[model samples]
Target: MELTILGTAAAEGWPALFCACDTCKRARAVGGKNLRSRAGVQFGKTHRVDLSPDTWYQEAHLGADMSALEYLFVSHSHDDHWQPHCLAYLRPPFAHANNTPVQVYGNEAVVRTGRAELGAEQTIAVFNEVAPLKPIPAGEMTVTPIVASHKVGEQCLNYLFASEGKNVLCAWDTGLYEDESSWKFVENVRLDCVILECTCGPSKCERYHMDYEHYLAFKERLEKAGSVSSECIFVATHFSHNVGILHDELEQYFSPHGVCVAYDGMKIVL
Candidate 1:
């Protein structure tokens, strides 16, 4: 399987859309990997995680193609991760040659948002409301939604993707798992890769999002659960400019701890 991290920044993006902070300034001047869009990922050419608002920019500049996407899994209804309007482009007058409907999986709010955006009669995509811990089959992979701790108003989710003897957990847009049951999935499934969020950077915000400290604790918990091995790849993404750590500095800090700092357009094959 081939996985491409389409973006690596938080909702505001690295350098932000409208900020003049020193971190943003440095990122703007440095360019290249220092610049990041809203967070999202694509698996091969058909499956994607989180439909960011920057999907168009990602496609135009980052060598990403949404034209052949067959499956989309949204973490929540957050604007940065779930831009429902993008589904509209899959229909006539906007898209071509791609006639197959994309299967979308998310919380109830996410399904409602997509349905409202596409209107009741639209058939370009099929929306599926997924529950936590229940596995859904997508092509050859089994995707299980794990409960996320970020949003209380909705049943936010993190995904565990299992396919071809590989188990990859995408755990972000959330803090540490609140309930012990949230860790139940890891008991039977070992992870080959983990992509987690370090949104608050150096601080420790364990309620809504993760900081570096929380990130470490989370990893340790996973290790204690025997969910990951020494060979498993651990990637940190969804950075905020408020963290004030640039790409190189982030590498300096995380690399020593055996964690990869994700940059926009980073690709990994498993």
Candidate 2:
């Protein structure tokens, strides 16, 4: 399986749209890895996780062939992650030769929001509502949505993707794993790669997102539980300007911990 980090910023993006903070300023000046748009990942060439607002930019600049996308797994209805309106571009008049609908998998809120925004038009995309812990066959991969500890009133999700004998855990946008059900799901799987959200960066941990300290503890727990081995690739992504660390600094801080700070366009094959 191949994983591509399309975008790696948190909700507001690195060097946020309206931010002038020291970290944002530094990121803008430094460019390169620090210059992120939003969080989104593409598995192989067709299956993707989260349709960020930066999807257009990713396709235009990062060479993402979204037109070839077949499966879209939305984490939640967060603005930074779920931007269903972008699918409108795939609809008639705007798009041509896109006959096959992209099968979208998500929870109730995500499905509702997608139908409300993208309408019943099956020309571009279709929604297939999913619940936590249920494994569904998507293309050549088996995807299991796990409940995420982020936001109230809606079920946010992390995903376990198994394809071609390799398993990847997309643990983005979640806080500490306090749910026993979520932990039970993790314990049974051997992860080849784990992508964690370090939205809070070096800051104090929050209820809905993880910081560096929180990530370390979580990784330690996973390792101890035998869910992740030393050979597993640990990646940190979904950064925020509020994290107060630039790309280089993030790499410096996490490298010793065996975590790769994901940058846009980073690719991994396992």
Model 1 TM-score relative to the real fold: 0.97
lDDT of 2 by residue, 1-270 (tens): 888999999898888998879988898888998899898889867899999989989988887777778899999999999998887777657877454688899999888888888766755778999978999998799999999999888889999999998899998888987678998898889989999998988889768999988899889888889998679999999988888878888888999999999999899989
Runs of candidate 1 exceeding 4 Å displacement: none
lDDT of each: 0.88, 0.88
lDDT of 1 by residue, 1-270 (tens): 779999898898888998989999999998999999997898888889999989999989888887888899999998989999988888777889374589999999999989999896458899999988989999988999999889888878999988999988898898888856687776567899999999988865659889989888888888988889779999999998888878898889898889999999999888
Q: Tell me how many clashing residue pairs each candidate has.
A: 0, 0
| Cα error of candidate 1 at position 6, Å | 0.6
Looking at model 2, residue 110 earns an lDDT score of 86
Candidate 2 shows a clash count of 0
